[model samples]
Target: MNVSQTMETEEDFLTRLHIKLYHPQQSCKGLYGMLPLGKRSSHPADVPLRLGRDAQACTYALVDPRVSRKQLALHAYRTAQSPDMLFTIQNLSQRGRLSVNSSALGYLERMDLPDKALLRFGEYEMLITRESGEAMGSFEVEFEVLEMPPSRETCMCVPSVTPVMELRALVPLENDETLCHL
Candidate 1:
């Protein structure tokens, strides 16, 4: 099949684009998840999704009473320098304070959000991260802390000749008779 003959769906095109919203606050644990952009509208008015408490008025809803029905908006803008869509968040709530990376935004104000940016609406917090092209990769790390052995001597000035038991590493021997030689 010719490349031009292949019809691309909105979901297929969106796979190339890495855009999502996630909640990462301690107060609201397990609320953390990614909300991916699935489609785009041809009409200009149809674009830009709104999020809030009310079920009908928002694309993404927050059930908390402290959140307004129309809390914020997620809009996309393209620039001459890059072909990828850039996103900016607009604050629409009257009572709810919107913040980007801990900086408060004025009412009806908009701010550019970068990848891995922290967004806060009152106590609700969300993280916006986009991984595109070759930069998309994840890794895991493990760490352990080793504790020191307790000493019999309490005074800091005095040095004890007694060896600390916990500081030694025990080696395994296959035969029990070999232990007496050491």
Candidate 2:
């Protein structure tokens, strides 16, 4: 296939994505520990949502010193084969890695997202779920964003080291290391 046929532009998708919160059942810290759970945010139409620490560039600015400035891009799309809107996600962070549904994605890597996807980077995690409420054959897809509870086993704020038999193991980050603390 030609480049034009294979690589479609944003306008080709012909759909928009809105990220909202439907239920606020649980209480938990959100982005930067300030955006509480279930908080709602609007997304720009005809453009991918930029998420990262760079407020000037990113649509969703996360507060994380350890995380890179420009992290992820979420693009909404649709095809002639299906009326339902789909999405493609790209990893923009140069230093940090993005794990989508347990699949690791390095810088510049992208993947076609499923209906429900869990995006994890560093100590932060973003949950995007598709909600179809339309009765028509052509489904209208809306997405919801939520912050998942931090995993205790992999908490970065407080580095926990297991007791080791050897004294060498006691010395952690022997010379230098990069880690997120809170």
Candidate 3:
């Protein structure tokens, strides 16, 4: 089976446990962690048991065996090479509030994140604003995992189109006023 087919099977497995799954196309190389939220009354068994990140940084969803249907939120954290790098949150639903908490606050003052950088959590898209006081951009995001069809026939050997060739050429150099040969 192909990559798409594998994705479908994984999605099926997650759905069986009633967990809302999201597949992120972006790489997770710099991601730190994710906070998944569910109904307060729900038991811990309803939470996702595993979260996977591939070598290329794609994120996959896995659910606990006992989870049931419920509204949930995921706070995914990421790290970058430098503070100048921007972080973004996008493709949120049109319901609920998105909140952000930073690790630091100034003396006698709470460091407030710029409104533009703060995403409302439920919008279609949200971004961490640029440092120059500009609004962060947004884009529509969608994910799909499909199954691969079984192969009807198989082939073994394949022929090469072109034979390998090796060649060497002498280098020529130019002098200040005349062409020089090396």
lDDT by residue (114-175, candidate 3, tens digit) is 32332222211123322221111211122222121101011001112322231112223442
Total colliding residue pairs, candidate 1 = 0
Error of 1 at 104 (Å): 1.0
Model 1, TM vs. native? 0.52
Off by over 4 Å in 3: 1-58, 62-83, 102-182
* lDDT of prediction 1: 0.49
2 or 3, which is superior by TM-score? Answer: 2
In model 1, where is the ten-residue run with the lowest total lDDT? 143-152
For 36-61, candidate 2 gives per-residue lDDT tens digits of 23443434435777777888887666
Query: Clashing residue pairs, candidate 1?
Result: none
TM-score of each: 0.52, 0.56, 0.16
User: What lDDT does candidate 1 reach at residue 146?
Assistant: 13
Q: Which candidate is the best by TM-score?
A: 2
Instruction: Give the winner by lDDT: 2 or 3.
Output: 2
lDDT of 2: 0.57
Q: Give lDDT: candidate 1, residue 154.
A: 18
